[model samples]
Target chain A: MGWFSWGNKNQDISEPSRQNRQKCWETRDSYFDCLDRANIIKPGDEGNSCAKEKQLYEDNCAKSWITYFNQRRVLADAQKDRLAQAQAQADSARK
Target chain B: MREVSHFVTLMFSQRALASLARRTYVGGQQTARHGRRNFSQTLKRQSQFGKDRNTIGTLTPASAAVFVATGVGLYFYFRYEKQKLLEEREKERSSRQYGRPQIGGPFSLTRSTGETFTEKDLLGKWSLVYFGFTNCPDICPAELDKVGTILNKLEPALGKTFLPVFISVDPARDTPERVGRYLADFHPAFVGLVGTYEAIKGACKAYRVYFSTPPNADPQGDYLVDHSIFVYLMDPEGQFVEAFGQNTEADQIAARITEEVARYGK
Candidate 1:
């Protein structure tokens, strides 16, 4: 009787505009997941969709979506780098 | 240039000597009032000469008795002052030991019983708080089971009751009724808390718990929330004591909590 996970069942997809936004976000996630699965984007590497060589099917993705996803990814990657650097420092201090 | 250097040195020496003399005079005055004889030999000799006149002929019995009584009084006075200082130092050390992390604060939430609960309500009793959503597939239920079992075991042995609290991070889906139903399956004494997203977030921040909803989750697909899986032990004063990680066994957790509650009783 349950078609989906109860936690995700309440997502607002009634409005067409909201549906488009959700679709765009899902597509971006899929593109990133595909890149990750294909080994095109390695873990711990800075994901820069803005780079011409790094663009993941830019023609298929909307420009606004691409910009939004790239900005968020860059911020997350920067935070990861900081966390790694802090971990290294702590390791050295422990030694 | 040599004459100027000599002049500066001479002036500095003069000032230093003057300050030393002033300090000695002040110290001598205080020593005189206290009948102490350390400041200056000259002052000591003068005090001894004056006392000798008072006792020139023979030691009066009244004066001898007064002297002995004053000596006894001085001994007790110094002993009492030393004891007070030691007690103050011990107090400072214990306060530093109780320097528990600043966690737990005012947060308005709804309990499973359709009652409003706040951090103030947790004032008088020790609480075991865990932050996780009811939809958690495995870890949340397993952890809650461990907590319930530990609480049950500890109660009979220690004869003490502890508030077992479950605060949901997924407030949007976890209504008070949903939380109530979920907790009912765990422990009879267990309480479930839910609130608006902002209120729940505030509580999480106060407790240093972290949770995030997965991004771009399918509306019609299975999903999981990523969060910290630690059961926080809060003392009666609403202060964080320690936390038990997910991997900790129920027996070990019970032993640890028993030791903690015993220590808390003291």
Candidate 2:
């Protein structure tokens, strides 16, 4: 069963090219920006507000990439909040 | 007479009585007093032959101590030398037997050109292998770029001796043509490999790579694959040499590979 599958003929899926990946990132950024304007930290929480941008994001990017980017967006926002809090604490300490 | 008896006692204590008895047996015609005179004469002859023999006859406490110390020192010196030789042999044997971990093994995968690539293809050239997917947005691209930098650094000194390879862990999406197109952005020398899921799994197992790609997952499903990010360096004989982590700098990897190539076949 394993030896017969060694041929490349069985592979039906093709990976994204460099240009496709760039488009995916652009669409992802646009979608995330829309989510930010709607005050939505989670990707699915934007409801029908960012529908056009979300459709482009889903179309341009791979499924796995969309998932990763969505998770990274929330994490990056949390990290930004923590950094701002730390800065405020440091300023109070200096005074 | 008392002095003569003391001399006789000293001769017996030093095991010289055997020689004295031989002399007495040889001169059986002589009287007992004549035999005693012969023993004193024999002692004088021995003293005249060697200064060391005369010193032994005197046998002072300080000289005896020096003799015993010399014997003990020589014994310990030879013992230490023997021990050192044994340890050196053991070190050599161990290095030949188990110095490196068993990492690389037989694997068959497809190259970007749709050619069959096996473990035998890794022979006769140094190879740096990375496992990643083309869909990886950040980490894989960043690592491939770093590999490009390393290759640029290694080109002049190493020439065509080193090969940079990228094998896709996400075989469901990474077809040969797609892998080729993806690698075209990094470096012209990069050889991208893709295979069936089972084939990719076998290659990963040979290199001890871990990936969290479900076997029967839908190709269109949106799920990120969690995988170990490392670059494996294989020697010319297809043996595992070293592994560079994600945090290792390109210059460091290049320097290490240059050093390893220089040390090869010596």
Candidate 3:
């Protein structure tokens, strides 16, 4: 009964604390850095390269956060490409 | 010299009367030759009586100038009045648009303290309502922090008359207790609300908030719910006054709310 109560308490306190969130962000950054070193624009593409870092990130952060971060990483890269293309077009137009 | 000026004025008056008679006679469609003979008789009579053709010539030009000036003045006067009327109408239309925004309506949800809260609860106080989930990693926290800053800035002067509310879009994962605990990290004055999926959907619809948390999604599953991030300002009467986007500065929002509160008092 005590074990069940403890589990209930854990379920009730679902949101991460401030320190836990910081830890999650740290792990996420480390994992993303590994992915960047591997030249992988997409997160899931680096299968075995950053497995340890990915495990740490998954354990620290919530599932929803992980999904959001992965999607945002890809989106940010795409946005960079678009901005570069726009800059090149602007330069050519100026000439 | 005065006698001579008076005589010239009398002569001009006589000439005006003669022209009036000629116009009336022409209106009757009399013979063209008869009209010409009458004009010649008047001219002969004028020449015999005064022999001052120079006075008549000069007076004609002066009267013509006065007539043209009066016509132009009337034209501009009417145009100015028309322009003023159009501007007044535009002002009234804009006031009507801003005075009564159709943003909020009937909604029911559970407050963080396990009490029933409805749109009626929003009445009698200015409320800042935001729609977000506790699981939002970065944006929601940043926005809530901004709201906290605004509340802290306004609380001293506006105290109790102002309320900040957070409504959870992710009902499946965010229970009232969880939402309450999450909001404790921000301003204590905040009223966190959560409800069943249908109730949350109705509330979102009432506020015109677009959230993408699917019904029947696994509560334990890891997925992000995309939603609109706008903080709505409602007047004491529960009518929406404005919606502040994510980029709006806390100072700007505070200034706006202070202005609105003053205006409402009036």
Say which prediction, candidate 1 or candidate 3, comes out ahead on DockQ. 3
Q: Rank order by lDDT, top first?
A: 3, 2, 1
Per-prediction DockQ comes to 0.04, 0.29, 0.28
Please tell me how candidate 3 rates in CAPRI terms. acceptable
What is the Cα-based lDDT of residue B20 in candidate 3? Answer: 54
Who wins the TM-score comparison?
A: 3
Which candidate's DockQ is highest? 2
Location of the lowest summed lDDT over 10 successive residues in candidate 2 chain B: B26-35
Query: Which of the two, 1 or 2, has more DockQ?
Result: 2
In order, what lDDT does every prediction score? 0.67, 0.78, 0.82
Candidate 2 per-residue lDDT, tens place, B1-266, comes to 34445544664554455354434444553433434565656655554665545343445587467656755666676678889999999899779757787888988999999999998988988998899987677788889989999989999877988788999988766778879988999989898988889999999999999998888855554456788889999999998889999899999999999888887855
Clashing pairs for model 2 are none
Docking class of 1: incorrect
DockQ of 3: 0.28
lDDT of 1 by residue, B1-266 (tens): 34445554664564345334434454554433332234245444434655543442323477557656755666676678889999999999789668867777788999979999999878777788999876564478778888899888888987566889999887656777768877877898888998877888888898887888543334333335568888988888888888889888889988888887888887
Ranking the candidates on TM-score from highest down gives: 3, 2, 1
Q: Candidate 3, residues B79-175: lDDT per residue as tens digits? A: 7888899999999978976787578899899999999999999999899999998878888888999999999999899887878899999988888
How many angstroms is residue B46 displaced in model 3 relative to the true structure, after the best TM-score fit?
Answer: 36
Residue B89: error of model 1 in Å? 12
How close to the true structure is residue A70 of candidate 3, measured as C-alpha lDDT? 92
